[model samples]
Target: MENEEETLLKSQDSVEKRLGRTTLLDSGEDFEMLEEVDDGVDDDLPPLEDAGGGRKESHQANKTVKEITDPSQCPPQEEWLDVLGNGQLRKKVVEAGSSPDSKPQRGQNVTINLKTTLTDGTTVEEESNVSFTLGDGDVIQALDLTVQLMEMGEKALIEAKAKYAYGALGSSSTPVVPPNADLILEVHLLSAVDAPDLELLPPSERISLASRKREQGNVHYQRGDYAFAVNSYGIALQITEASSKVDISPQEEEELLDVKLKCLNNMAAAQLKLDHYEAALRSCVSVLAYQPDNIKALFRQGKVLALQGEYADAIRSLKRALKLDPSNKTIHAELSKLVKKHSEQKGAEQAMYKKMLGNPPDINTVQKPQAKSSWSISWKWLFGATAVAIGGVALSVVIAARN
Candidate 1:
């Protein structure tokens, strides 16, 4: 008795034969199925909440902010002092700080409580205990520039023109600000600490600090601010490298190395997004130097090399990655595309060379002298005969006439 599988197969074969075609089968190609790659494009950077765990700055805007429409309720213009001398930014000290002589400088990491509002007293953003490195552009220009003028524990009110705030295109995120909207901010300088010399810190502390910076970078990256992301990652990298000379336990050293590699990889990702191909490639090479088999580094290195027109090296790196993870559809898809592109490039180069050299005409197509037709040859002979006869008759007539 024929089983169901056998019957189906037989029927299919018969139909294929009748149609004069063989049934399709897998060609065993390495990259047969193309799929979308998660090449860290949409990847969520490691969350800051668990990274060192001291404080995570709030990104949520104040949804229930109240609006005060009365003009009388606003601060008087007489008390506002121009901080920048350009009149774009003005400050009014609400309360004096504890340390009058010590103010936070540009490079210090500072913590603060801030409340921002529109000109009509509509609060747009409010957060407490938010910390950021000064002059890092982590906050709005108004906050960054205004906070510099305040001493430790000082409370101040700032009025920033649109140029110093969100500019013509106002805030697009939550608590959206309209275009060309001037802003008012109430700022409390909680504390200011100078960025420590990483080399002086113990290895454990250095690693923790580096991790925190890396988390900060992640935050910047998630917000689509690639340049700032690169900066934060670069700072984290500096912190990581600073601890390498310090004597530490083997475990601590290993952990530090891991963190350093992660920072490099993340930085490379950011650099790639920014189209800084050379810088991104160098970062990938740095990671590969420490850990040759690092998959993420290898993958990114391949992409960077391809962008720089180094197809051979790119293919090599991607092949290595694919070897490590043979089943990764994303890697397979990427490698296939690169291989196809390289082939097309070679083909185009060959075509261009052929065009420059100019193809020789085929011997068969070259025109040969045509043999004269019988009719034309006969006509030429007849004309020559007639000319000769006429000349002879004329000569004879002249001789007879002279005689």
Candidate 2:
């Protein structure tokens, strides 16, 4: 029995050594360790920690891995800077030529001449003079940074990301800059111009003048005084033109075109109102040439044609207008009345011709006798057969009675 116990103990110790773990032997009242291994084997292993602690503990490792994967997370290699003082530096460069100077001073007005294409495929050549106080929030962040670094009359090329320009929302009129888009710009510092003072002309007076002119034009147009309305519109156009030139900018070109289009359209309306059908037609045609799909021009053209006694042409024009504006009850009523009058006139002419010619038959008419229908023929045959049978039956009955 002692020999068997010794053999079992030795076998257990061999198993524990092979597994690299400490094992205990049962000795009736006490336990004994069978294997002894060094503590250095698993001492360097990671410590078991909770989720939060684990993240905090492994932050350095995670950062290392991220740096290896993405190099953009590293610090910028070159300092990104902007030379223009405005947020629109990128757009300015693309539209205008590069600036000649190297620095711009505080309170300096920069004038830039630019040529830009409109959304409607119209090209506008214009000049812009921008003046703002340095270090003010009036300029974009990137532009402000550049201005701080520059001296008076200095110019430089600036690259701006969209975040520094218009950001994600973009400008209302033109969306040149997109979100996160990188842009390049060249800027110049021109002679500074003094800001206009409202004290010279009272704000109230300015407002009153604008309101009075607009009201005068409206009243004249309503009262069928087209010449007066045209004159007023001309004055308004002049004012807008002057204002646009005073603040010479690339965007002003678009505004100028709009003003001109409005003036031309209003002038045409006035001419039509004054019973000058030919002149009105010419004006409308001119506008149509510029804007082929102008609804007002199309309507005015149709009205002028109708006034000129060109009923067919008027109808065609009005029909086209109606197609463009189907829900227009006024156009529908007008067309209906014209079509009815034309039909009535034709009917009256035909009646007069028939009376003059003694109701002569038309050359295309046929004069054939009307034939009876098959149903009527069948009914007649049946009636005749019934009458014959009745007479024969009466004769046979009389002969039988006599026999």
Candidate 3:
């Protein structure tokens, strides 16, 4: 059966999120719609209290988030660290994480399961798993920082003070977060991988990548992994299209053509295996359009046509392929079977027509015969020798009357 399995594997709830359009600023800060998340370990986490018994005030004369002038009533975060000078955020490493070496970077895709809460300890958001690229600004700046610091399989607690979070504006997805409210985030990092930006690579390098992907698809195909093969071949095709720039050398053009031809053949084979007849036919046709007499294209095209019950057209395609590759046993076997099926189909059609309306007018003489006369049923000598007439009174009366 034809299936749709992409190359990248994903855990449940761990796919990319849809944050709105993000514009990267000149300050290297990503500003986008961010998801609200918080640690769920504690149901009654205390609200963030200003060290001065209210919102922290800066001493830069503007009363920004930095300069804490008063230390009146502050919520104690014993395990948390204020790595940056600003009191706007704090981080607590819940688990150092199983994978010790690697963590998400500035421009990589990360997948994790996360939960978020408000300062009053009400759960606002949670995902069993999700994925997003770091530094994309599809989320708030605090999340990007948190993921960057997390290693694979690690869990952490992130407290984004109102300044680094919704600020005074709050969030668009939910109505719970009041203006200037802080957020708590807890996450379990599942995986972090580098997301490819294919457009950035040069044409030759893209072609090389495409070729490698195509080979990978072939491996998948050989193992009867049609779904994976389809995805792999699709990637190769995308890269091939990217490399097809208008300003290419003649040799490069030839190289790309060869690559495209092989890719089409492989893709068609996989699609056919998966019973995606229409897509497989299209791929084969595309190859034929480039190189009309390609044996593999012709051969696969015939198989697709046969599957559609177009035996006559299939026979022609198969015969053409056989002419090109006479020694190929596979082609020979398929063509022979198709020939027999075509003959049988024609015979059945004629039989059905005859059964419905009898044979054609010219063939109707088989049932015609001339009528035989009644005189032919008797001999002449039996006329006067009838036993019933010998003793008949009518004959005697006629004889007496005549006398």
Which candidate comes out best when scored by lDDT?
A: 1
Best candidate (score: TM-score): 1
Per residue, candidate 3 scores C-alpha lDDT tens digits across 241-360 of 763324566786677778888889888877777789999999999999999999989999998999999999999999999999899888898888889999999999999988998866
The whole-model lDDT of each prediction reads 0.73, 0.48, 0.65
Candidate 2 lDDT over 178-253, as tens digits, reads 3344433344544444433323433333334433444445444543344556666555544443432133445545
RMSD of each: 25.9, 31.7, 21.7
Candidate 1, residue 371: how far the Cα is off, in Å: 24
> By TM-score, how accurate is candidate 1?
0.65
Q: lDDT of candidate 3 vs native?
A: 0.65
User: Which residue pairs in candidate 1 collide?
Assistant: none
- The predicted structure with the larger TM-score, 1 or 3, is 1
- What TM-score would each prediction reach against the true structure? 0.65, 0.33, 0.46
Indicate the worst ten consecutive residues by lDDT in candidate 2. Answer: 25-34
Write candidate 1's Cα lDDT for 155-174 as tens digits. 88787888777666565564
lDDT of 2: 0.48
